[model samples]
Every structure is written in C-alpha cells, then in structure tokens.
Target: MTNAEPPAPRTVVPIEPSLLIAEAFNQAQVTALRHSVTSCSHAAGLTGQRLDDFVLAVNELITNAVRHGGGQGRLRLWRRPGELICEVADHGQGISVRRLSERARPAPDTAGGWGLWLARELSDTMAVETGEAGTIVRITAALAAQPVTRPADS
Candidate 1:
C-alpha cells in the first residue's frame, strides 16, 4: 500500500459551436484560419480602427501557436453582445504566467518575444489557461456601438 491522491479533473474550455471559426490549425492551414477569424470578426461588426486592432492582436497569438505551440493549434471567434471574442488553443507545453509578462516591451533589436504582451495590450480583456497538456488564450475586444444614422429630410 502507498499514499497517493486521485488525479485532478481537466479544465479545458468548451468552444461554443454557434460561433466557432477554425477548429484546428496546422502548418498548412494557418492562413485559412486567419481568414476565417477576420471574416467572423467583420461579420460581428468590428470595423475601422477597432477592427484593425483586433486582427493584429489575434494574429500575434496565432503566430505564437504556430511557432511555439507545437506547430499546430485551434482558433475560434464569436460575438458576445457588446464584444467580439477570439480564442486560440495549442497542445504544447505551457508557459508560466510570470514568464509570460517578464518584459514590458521587447528590445528593438530583439528577434521576438512580444506576442502575449501585445495581445493583452490590444484586447479589452484576455484570459490564459495553461497546463502540462495544453494552453488556451481567450481575448475579447469591446465592439464600439455603431452610430445610428437617419435619412436627411428636404
């Protein structure tokens, strides 16, 4: 007999199918996923400066998923009332939260190290879920209330 505890239950977030984009991204499929994410974002009514910001932030995360996240992952996008949500998940070793924020900004000459930081800065809110099995980053950008325009009267 030996002292041992039961394994903990997993905490992977379930993707909402109603608004899901790409279910998985591989080395050859990243471009398609990017297009899907942007198209969904556009259809969700993201536009102008806010639209560009959201795309940039999400692109960084996708790049990280390809370069660092075992060269494959998943991407999803959806609309939530006043916000647009994007989620990227990878089946690779996780990075600690502390390490994720080590630098405020990378040096100009530095080859890289700015993906996660930029995501947090650009998105309205971001959450990170990581473990030995995988990592998922969910980011939200508040949708600017579209201006109501009325027809001009003679």
Candidate 2:
C-alpha cells in the first residue's frame, strides 16, 4: 500500500461559534474564552443579536469550567442545527448532576453560583458526561434565523 496518511479525526474547521484551546489554568482559560467568542463571531459572520447570544454563552461556560471543572480544560464550539453547541472538557474528578443542580442555585445577594445559573438560563439544553478521559460539560443555545420582531404588525 502507498504511504498516504488518513484524514484527521479532529479537524478544526471554520465554525460560526468559537473554540478555545488552553491549559487548565484559570488565566489562560479566561483569555481563551474571550478569543473563542471573537473567533466564532468572525467566522460565523455573527453581528448584533447573534453576537450578544454567543458572548453571553461563552462567558458562562468558560467561567464555570475555571471554577468547577478542576483547574484546566479545553473548549470547543460549533453551529449545530439552529443552535450553538459548546463542549468544555476538563481532567477533573468529575461532577454529579445532583451536585451541579444544587450548586447551580445562586445564593441571595451573591454572585457566586451565577455562572452555572446563567449557563442554564442562556442554553436551551445542557448536559454533563464524565469518563476516564475526563468530564465534558455540553451547553447549547438556540439562534434565531432573523432578528426577532416585537408585536404590533398584524
């Protein structure tokens, strides 16, 4: 057989959403998050309303991983269906759904649990999958095809 190489499994394509590549460190994670959003916006041709949704979701997911996903992780985002899907994978011990639900409840007069809370609010669907590889928290936010209009016209 010839020595031709096979296609790469994890190919980074032009995503309408952002993808972050960084260590498990907090500072790096933060910078990666911001860059991911900008990249996504630019790649997806996002503007105005789309930008708002993407920025909000990106911040929430990145913040959550930094605080709860054990320290370091990798983030990947893409346009799936009509929604933006983000996957934040970390090499932490992993978290239970029950624990996540409890922690997601923000305390009164405090901003601490707000990341998870905001993630849940902005995302149409959220789920956690843990294994020997690590834990990957997936978050998805729906995107409107066109700018939503207020009522008034018949």
Candidate 3:
C-alpha cells in the first residue's frame, strides 16, 4: 500500500458574504467597529485567551487601515471548524507585505509599526495581499476550550 499526504488547505480563498460578519468602517467609526468584531468573534465560538488575541489582532488591523488605508476600509470575520478567521482590507496605496513580514521586530516602546507584527504574532496563520488597488490581510487562530480557573491561596 502507498501512503500519500492530503492536499493542503487553501488559506487565501475568497470568503462568501453570508459566511459570517462583514462590515465597512472609516477613521470616524473604529470604536463601534471593534464592538461588532468582538460580538461576531464570540458568536463564532472563540473564548478565553484565544479570543483576546483575536480581538487584539483585529483592532490593530482595523486601526492600521483607518490611519493608513486612505482613512477607511473593510473587515470580515468567519470560522472554519476549529479555527477563527478574520480579514481586514483597505483601499490605500498599499505596501510591501513581503518587507513587513521580514521585519525582525519593532521596539515595544514605539508608538508605531506594530500592526502587521502584532497580527502575525497573535494568529496561527497570516497571509497578505497587496497591490495598486488595495491590501487585504487574513489571519487565522485556533479555538481552544475554556481553561479551568483555580482559586489562589489567601
């Protein structure tokens, strides 16, 4: 008998509009956008620290889009079995996503340059698409069951 490896999953495939939460936002509407993302994430079955990481990643992406993506952009969030997925897109001049991925690390104390880095760190898988048209960043993180909380000694 011959053994063969299964085909790899397509990480950059198009996301259907009805698959999950989808919204558009601009610089003026980030606060409300964050809330909506959190709600969608919760509904998609993420909790505990994994949920927190996903939330932070989306916040960074959306904030980056607002500040840099021509002052507006769109966000999409979805799920696939054990994974939670999110995508942030912007219609700006775009960037060298390759360079962004190669960066060693930005200073923690700096106020800027943390968006791409943070998203990569927080998610299990990250993909980037950029061009003269716009840029779309997709990230995926695995969902974990709730951890047991223990009482500390008083």
Q: lDDT per residue, candidate 3, 39-83, as tens digits? A: 878887777787788889989999989888889998888777678
lDDT of 1 by residue, 1-154 (tens): 9778888998986566448575787779867777777788888888887888888888888888888889988887877768889999998888777867574777878788889888888889989998888789999988878888999998
lDDT against the true structure, per candidate, is 0.83, 0.66, 0.83
* Stretches of model 1 off by over 4 angstroms after superposition: 1-20, 146-154
Model 3 has a clash total of 0
* lDDT, model 2, position 81: 47
Who is ahead in TM-score, 2 or 3? 3
Model 2 worst lDDT run, 10 consecutive residues:
15-24
Q: Pairing residues by index, what is the TM-score of model 1?
A: 0.79
Candidate 2 per-residue lDDT, tens place, 27-125, comes to: 465875677666775455566755666567667766666676666667776775466677777776766666675744577888576766666666667
User: What is the alpha-carbon lDDT for the whole of candidate 2?
Assistant: 0.66
Please tell me which predicted candidate would have the highest TM-score against the true structure.
Answer: 1
Steric collisions counted per model: 0, 2, 0
Candidates, ranked, lDDT:
3, 1, 2
Quote model 3's TM-score: 0.77
Residue 110 lDDT in candidate 1: 75
